[model samples]
Target: MSPGLKFIDFSIMPVLLGAGSCRRFLKTRMLRKMTIKHYSSNRRSNSPDNQYSTIAEIKEKMMKSFGLEPGYTTEPKSREELLKYQPKFEDLPARSMQDSFSSAIIPLSTDAVLQDKYINFRGFARLGRLLEDMDLFAAWCCHRHLKVPNLPEGVPLPYSIVTVLVDRIDFTSVSPNGTQDIRLSGHVSWVGSSSMEVVVWLEQVVNEEYQKITRALFLMAARNATNTAAAPVNPIQPANEEEKVILAGGADRKKQRQILSAQSVFKVEPNAEEQSLIYQLYKRTTPVEQTGQQRLLPPNCIWMHDSFQMSTIPSFPEHRNQNNTVFGGFLMRSALEISWATAFLYCKARPQLEHISDISFQKPVSVNSFIKMTAYVVYTKENYLQIMTVAEVLDAYTGSRVTTNAFHYTFSAPDPVTEVLPRSYHDTMWYINGRRKFKASRG
Candidate 1:
């Protein structure tokens, strides 16, 4: 028999009852109850012992709470098959948002064997790993809402999904330990002709109450399985007033994105409003002589090149997803860490990710290629620090580099930040764009 084949016994069982047998069964039942009670008592709310003391304890608690394990069955059952144990029929309409709304509650955990790699320097869960999980959840949400293809049945065509952009992610707060129960919920916020907006929210459950922690907006695109072109998706009909508002917001954001893309500071010329602002900024600009402690001009101003930090790491196969490129979540995590570290050093205090916007995936980084990431402090406003991070693929032999991603982060520090000034046109472009993104992020 092949390893892929699993078998189940269908033979009937004969039952024999005796006084001693009944007593044994009762004893087993009582023991199981006592064990569960003991476990529950030890992990009671507000108990110091409830917290995870080590990685092994976290793994044990998560396994008992969520029963999560890697690897699925040899082949996954289709949505219809899993729903009713029936084969899928031909010519089905696209799925609806309600079909994709899913929720789960579980205590966070670190894999015992891979604990070091899954945690950041602060001993908390790595943002990159969480991102990977969120990406998977978003994909599943979209898949659940997809209509069955209208094709002859033999083998279904492969499904292709990619995350084109992450509009905004706000990290309000995070638990310091993995012992807290986290509630994850997501649904399709809006649908375009071939695109979808997935709103995923992460919250921590404390004392039977939910506390919002983080939320992210992801823009995903569906493509034809054969040609990899834009594929038609089911149109979403807003079911209620709340949904109507959410859909309207999504549409408005889409429109704003289109307009901004065309009028971005990266262009050669600025618009009338931007031109006026630039003129005022340069005309009133006071040149510092690179001296005087209280001047707050030259000393506070950090050059993009001087403030730039770089890290080189190889793209391992473990980071690849079904699309055969590096996972977006991993990239996000790595980029965020670098930016946070830079912010932390500059502020002389801890910095938290207040907002991340316009994370664009320009291209996929190939497996086995070296990824060189650069982080620069693009702008600063009082307590807010904006860092622009770029990820590129570096060819060692040719010494060539090609950009793969661009991420913008706004971090709030405990103390005020020394303002950064753009000395050149290129730096000014980033500064203007960063300010624009900051405004949009506020909305």
Candidate 2:
């Protein structure tokens, strides 16, 4: 949580806490059991029917989307062969925007989509799964920026890149089910001493035209494998005014983050402008006796931790990235899925992500570690709801847990929410900050 610490290092910390040691601090058994039950039910709702025709149909749709021919090579790329071609930073070849470009076509699994009364019927691609694809592409864009040549055998280059933040993602459209292909592409927009801002966009073909589904800004940091410390990233060369502008935007975002970290709303008193806004909010308040409105937080109001919570299956090999840790994109998707459920429950309608203010990976979660995700409705305004999801790793042996990732999401629902009122000063600060985010997003 210290400013000096860009992220938490779990390797140096004590082992995760045991379940018994963490019990009191966790949700009640009945609630947790229900959470698991609800998760299972959702999975069942989306499970595949195991029909051969269904699988074949999805595969054919994907191939067309990817523009792949029947005779295309299907052999797996060999890692050993790729490693032989690994190039050092300086030895890396020069690349243009097209050279750095890459894309993937994957079949959308039925089980990955969530069905809810509040969601639109046109499509059901889970936001978490969609984000996972976006993260991978952004990482690939950074890899190309480093100009690491492809190995003859498909071996990955020896280097490490990790996602530090998903600063923002604006969802512009939804990819429908009939439009099966999820297209992702990105390029390095800016570079710092050791950080690169990779901008990625998600798209799909609709009515014979490409529809942009989402555009995201991902902040990634390069590292040395030997020491696992920050390492310099390859600088980007802007070719046109558009690129130059994008590069500047990335730099500005970094500066904004620095300024925000230093003077977060929770850490300091409001300035004149912010104080004026707060005063306006207070002045607009009406007396409950006259307005016949609810006063204070209702006793039955939902607390963030009390509902829609679930722990992830232990991190596994299949989910590991080049760093041999759980993929950052996977974590992002996981958090989003749980937060979506939380928002849906509160709204009793469909909720869509409008903004992901930030996703800070405080610690790298190693493979096999257990993760518990908790979502809280920290603030709400009109039809927009601000949810914060915190991820922590539990040390089964030591019964210790350390917070690893914090994700802030803003969702817009069809209906206005029954506002969540803060009962304490700490809660009030968070509420005010949430409102600040809402206002900033509008601008």
Best by lDDT: 1
List, residue by residue over 249-351, the lDDT tens digit for candidate 2: 6677888999988788767897788677555444344344445553343543544334345665587766766555788978988898889888898888978
Off by over 4 Å in 1: 1-94, 105-118, 121-123, 149-157, 174-176, 271-297
Task: Give each model a TM-score.
Answer: 0.73, 0.69
lDDT of 2: 0.62
Clashes of each: 0, 10
Best by TM-score: 1
Taking every candidate in turn, the Cα RMSD to the unseen true structure, in Å, is 14.3, 17.3
lDDT of 1 by residue, 77-141 (tens): 33222122112323346454455665444445424445455556666666655666676667656
